[model samples]
Target: MPRWRSRTRAERRLAAEQQGHRGEALAGLLLQMKFYRLRARRFKTPVGEIDLIAEKRGAIIFVEVKSRGHQGSEAEALGAVNSARIVRAAQYWLARHPAESGKDMRFDVIFLAPGRWPRHLINAFSAS
Candidate 1:
């Protein structure tokens, strides 16, 4: 078993939070390299929150960042529940930014694991 498997709930929470931060950082850097303009980070709405929002070439991307010490859980982290939340949050975001409402939107997921490069999945899910 992994060391985290033995950790308490609170410990695991803290570790997860730290991992999320690191993952977001890496994702942001990757987006920057791709020349995407970051519009938001940790965007919050009444329904849910989006980890990152970036725009490039008239398209806006809503990104979900997930980090785990084990790569196996990456798929689990990007499950339906998470995608639904991101869609809801993105809706809220678009409502608040009416000027950008006409732009094309895409949902993306960035998975991070220890000692591995961050993997960005574009158009990973959809609101529909």
Candidate 2:
């Protein structure tokens, strides 16, 4: 009988999307606080989309942001990420920005859950 229980499928989907956007914003802010310059928020390529792109000390970082409703679901949220798709997207991004090709690049993930600080996993995955 909760209000959320009454939400239609579309409503739930919209709410999820909103939550995802908020998570990405929070993640970007976290990166900035750590001296990382944000290059893009949502970088979409023909292959896929990267939630965030950042740079620090001449290193390019491709980040995937994942959010969940409760604490202790970090692993579950991380499991949802498709590293291969993100890697392909990063490749496409690099093709357009040839300047970044020679820079040291890595993949990262920022996990978010209610009542917890953002968890930043650096070098969380690799393109190889």
lDDT of 2 at 93: 92
Clash pairs, model 1 backbone:
none
TM-score of each: 0.87, 0.93
Clash-forming residue pairs, model 2: none
- Residue 127's lDDT within candidate 1 is 85
Q: Global lDDT for candidate 1?
A: 0.88
Q: Kindly list the per-residue Cα lDDT of model 1 for residues 1-128, writing each as its tens digit.
A: 65555788999899888878888988999999989999999998999989999999999999988877786666677773377778888999999999999999999988887778888889998888
